[model samples]
Target chain A: MEFLSYTFMRRALLAGNMVGVIAPLVGVFLNLRRLSLIGHTLSHVALAGVALGLFLGFFPVYTAIIVSILAALAIEKLRRDYRDYAELSLAIILAAGLGLATILISASRQSAGIHSYLFGSISLVGTRDIYMILPLALVIIAVILKYYYGFFYLAFNENEAWLAGVPVRTLNVVFMVIVSVTVALAIRVVGTLLIASLITIPVAAGMQVAWSFKSTIWLSLFFSLTAVNLGLILSFYYNLAPGGTIILAGVVILLLVLLVKKIWLLLRRDL
Target chain B: MSFLKVEGVSFAYRKERVVDDVNLELKQGDFAAFIGPNGSGKSTLLKLILGYLTPTRGEITLKGQPVAEIMDWTRVGYISQQVKDFNQSFPATVREIVGSNLYSKMGLVKFLNQELEKKIYRALELVEMEDLINRKIGNLSGGQQQRVFIARLMVNDPELILLDEPLAGVDIRAQDDFYRIIGNINQEMNKTVIMVSHDIQVISKHANKIVCFEDGRAYPHCSQEFSYDDYIHDLRRTNLRIIPRHDH
Candidate 1:
């Protein structure tokens, strides 16, 4: 309860919970579309952006988000060329991103306590970060609501969706940008390395019992929100990194769900 | 006079042309099936018609307009050969799958009204999948999945239906039933249907027109000509089987 009084902890919770709602919200489509790993790739791209921002003396977080968004649009365009072997584009982008990040890190030499972005620090999430996160999170939710079936159909079967006049290309670009911005902002709540876990594991856990797309979303949101809050609270008292603890909480829930499903099946067979 | 036309459509992959210098035409209410051996470019031609690939050298038109210029594809329904690409573990029910087709029209402004719900059920009933509306799509058999897809297409009541290898993994009886449903759709609805298929025998029964692809060329035939050729081919195949007569 004393932790709630701290401004930094409260900001982390607010930002983390907003991320908790969106990471898996976009994740359900990503996993269904088999683009779950794109989150990780874009986060690496975010690293390059952060390095650029550091070298240029601008706010790193803002630069990272803008850079990753541009990278998303580029990836979407490249994705069109390498349709069957779409991962080729991802590999190319990842290499370029990492290469840029390494060079910038070397040239800038501003590596002073940079683990905050690499891992995530509650104290780093300022009032301005909340302003940025809240609006972005709302936009993601609103887009999902507006084009709910379009996104679902694209995930279910993209070519048919194209014929069904779902505006697949436009939706794809919109989706990629959403994922990019999510991964970029999520770096502050969970780290660049661990962000995909928030987008993947909770959805995986939800899919165990989710019978419909709606159920999948609801179940995933439930697991994610719980894990994120639990991780924030646990980290506060136990002195652990919030990102690691949050992802670990998600992983634990996934494992427990698997265990319970297996036991339930076994018991039913016995009857 | 034609509902769809392809003139000198020479489509190539890289430097190698697949559908080369092809000319094809279909009248209104015609069910044209493309049939040929593997790598004969029937599928590529279908993709060209679907505006997926631009021809290296010619023109394709639907209803007097080039497919490239036709922006609104709502009147067109397609079921691709990549049904296998449907993630077997995706958490979508049959109702959701069929109902989602109406989203392009109803997504922004409307919820599931009674008319849309009825439309979904009617499409399902047309494909004999009404009872499984709530069932998860992944749990269905291959044949059942195809039926669900057909139902998905039927929800829109499109004027044009394109299917690529629609019966790849379906069972024998189900294949027959599939043809019946498609035949009914063709005759009763008066919709234009074009399909790429390996099952020439079954297709011949339903298709009013047959276009054979071979060696980067297309040869169009009326049902009368195709039936005669199919009979000769079947006879030759049966005669050749005499050299290795067995339970097979």
Candidate 2:
């Protein structure tokens, strides 16, 4: 309780909780649309951006933002042009970004940049970083809530939505942009390596028991907050990496849900 | 003028012509079925009508205006054969699925308030699915899914409804219910319906008109003299080898 009185600890807690909330909220749609892999791919692209920023003498966050948006555009264009081979296109972009990062890192004079981005140092997060991430997360969440129906329609059945005048192409671009923004904002807390888990695990856990779309979203948000808060507390106590621990906690919870669901089914049959 | 006029329309995939030199017209409030064996371009023609595919030659006009110039899409509703293509485990409620039709009408920035909620309830009620509004789409049976899709279509208040194989994979009781529901939509609402069906016997019994497809062309059969027995005999005899195997 004494530790919670510190401003730094409070700031870290707030930031971690915000990220945990936003990631899974967006993730419910991402998982449904089968775009979970995009999270991983964009995080790797951010890694390249961070490495490039170190070499070019710019703010890594700004570089990460630019690189992530570019990756999103490339993904959207690739999917449109090669709709039949979209998966291959995603793989190619992911590989290219990672390869660029590897080359940049090998030629760099300093190694601190790679280490910081790989394993996020949440304790080192500044007030400036919090200010940047908070509004971005808020705006993205607000936009998503406003256009929930359009996104749901487009994700479920694109052709039917198109015929009903849903501006399918524009919505697709907007959705990709949202994903890019979330990945960019999450980099400080979750890092590039395990950010996708923050997006995927909560939704996976919620799906085991959710019978409705609205309930599923709420459940995902609950699981995500629990994992992040718990993981942060454990990390602070044990002096471990917050992002990795949070992701592991989420996975464990998801497995437990699956186990419980299976047991319930078995018990019902026996009766 | 016809409610829908498709003139000299020809469509091809890559280099293979699927609908060749075809012409069709449907009057307002007509309930018509397009029937044929596999790959006979029944679905292709419907796609052309819905503006999903471009014709290599000629144009499609809706109510005297060219379909390309028509910006109002709320006037049309469509249901595809691939509703089951969605992930069975996707997290969406039956109400959400039905309510999705309102997106285009409400635009992106609008919120779904109490009035809209009432409309969603009404739409679900029409399909007799009001009680299952909170149920996940994945949990519903095939017929139920089709009904939910119908409820989605109804919210749009379309002048024309295009359905692709709505009866496929639905059980007999569900099919009867579907037919009755469609009958009510046509008779009560006076909405034009164009459907693609393989059940020639059922189509003969229920559909007001039939459009037969063979060798990449569509021919309309007048309901007054159309015989179910003769039509079945001709269909079975003409395409014996290509007939798909039936499980039941």
Candidate 3:
């Protein structure tokens, strides 16, 4: 009870819960649209932005958010310009961001902040960080829930959606923006290296059990909440890296779901 | 005024003109079919009318208004070939797939609610897929998937429906059923339909008008008495019958 009373613990829980909710919500569509790799790419772009901010003596969060949005726009434009080879463009951007991040980190004399950003330390989460993450998470959730059908339609069949007047292109841009914001906000908790797993694995696990699209989204949210909360608690207890632990928790849950699905199928066949 | 007018339209892919010097017109509540051999510009012409591709030189008008200017796409519905361009593992139910058509009508600001749910089921019922609302789209048979796609087109309640080879790969029984459904949509709903198909026999029975494409020009055929001999000759010369089968 005393441990729960600590302000830092309360802040960490709130921040972790915020990211836990937003990542998987976006992840459901992300996984469906085969844009799961965008999360990883944007995270690395955010890291490069953070490194740049560190080099320039400014707050890394603002720089990270701006850089992520730019990266998102660049990716969207590249996809449009090179529709035939969009994946190749994504790979190029990802490589550029990662390569630049490595160079910036190596060139810097100040290594402490870079290490902190590499593997997130949730103990460093302050009130301001909570304030920044909470509203963004809320906004992302609200927007996605409000336009669930649009995203679903766009993901399921883009050409059909266009014919039916779904504003497929504009909705695509909006979706990418939401993904950029989610990745930017999630950096504090999940870090850049493993954030895609945090977004993807929970949905992968949820898909195994969910019968309908709506159920899959809800179950993904549930899995995310469980993994993030448990991962946060375990990291607190064992003095481990929070991002690494959360991702590991997600992977473990995915494995369990796959095993359960396999067993259920075998048992049904036997019966 | 014609319900739809396509004038002087020419479409090309990288300097290779696929649809050249084409003109077409459809009256209100007409059932029309576009037929051609392989690469005869049937699908390309449909794409131009649907605004998926820009005509290198021409205009398409719907209800006497330029299609590009009128952004109200609720009046236009489309079903493409059964190509399965989507991943087979995609997670969408039959109801969700059909309900997606409502998005354009309902707009982006609205959420899918009970009213939308009812409409989706009603659309499914129209195509006899009310029983399979919960089935995953990928799990259905090819015929069943075509029915679902038809249901998807139905949800919008469009005045004009364009279909690209709805019977491309289905069994004969399914094809007959599909043609019956199209007849009902045209005869009962009075919706204008323009389908691109190669089946002359089925089109002769179902469609009120037919347009055959050969050598980049469209030849309109309105009567059932038009010789299948001409079509077969065009098909042999242009080799339109050799459709590249898409791997599902």
Winning candidate number (TM-score): 3
Residue pairs in candidate 1 whose N, alpha carbon or C atoms collide under 3 angstroms:
none
- Regarding TM-score, does 1 or 3 come out ahead? 3
State which candidate, 2 or 3, has the greater DockQ.
2
lDDT of 3 at B94: 89
Interface C-alpha RMSD, model 3: 1.8
lDDT of 1 by residue, A1-271 (tens): 9899999999999999999999999999999999987887898899888888888888888889999999999888888887887798888888899899889877886766457878877878999889999999999988888888889989998877777677888999999989998988898889877888999999999999898889999999999999999999999999999999999999999999999999999999999
User: In candidate 2, what are the lDDT values of residues B1-248, reduced to their tens digit?
Assistant: 79998899888898888888878888888889988766778899888887777889989988888777767777778888886688887878887787778776674574566777788898888888899999888889988988998998888788888999988778889998898888889888888899898777776777777887765777777444545554555567666533343652
DockQ of predicted model 3:
0.60
Instruction: Please provide, for model 3 over B1-248, each residue's C-alpha lDDT reduced to its tens digit, 9 standing for 90 to 100.
Output: 89999999998888888989998899978999888676888888887887777789999998888777767676777778834577667777888778777775564464666888898888888888899999998899888888888888788788789999878778989898898888888989888999988877668788888898776678787445456676677667864454433441
Residues A1-271, model 2: lDDT tens digits: 6659767767778888888888998898888888899999999998888888877877777788889889999999998899889889889999999999889888776757678678776786789878878888898889788888778777787656776677788888888888887887778887889889999999999988998777888999999999988887888888889888888889889998999999999999999
User: How would you encode candidate 1's per-residue C-alpha lDDT over B1-248 as one tens digit per residue?
Assistant: 57898999998788898988999998879999987666778888888888878898889989899999987676778888886677898899999988888886684642466889999999999988899999999999888889999998889998789999998878888898898888888898898999987666668878888888776788888455555356335446545321122332
Q: Which stretches of candidate 2 lie over 4 Å from their true place?
A: A266-271, B107-110, B222-248
| Stronger candidate by DockQ (1 vs 3) | 3
lDDT of 3 by residue, A5-63 (tens): 77877788889899999899999999988888888899999898888877777777778
Candidate closest to the true structure, highest DockQ:
2
Arranged by DockQ with the best first, the candidates are: 2, 3, 1
Instruction: Tell how far residue A240 is off in model 1, in angstroms.
Output: 1.5
Q: Give, for candidate 1 chain B, the lowest lDDT window spanning 10 residues.
A: B239-248
TM-score of chain B alone in model 1? 0.87
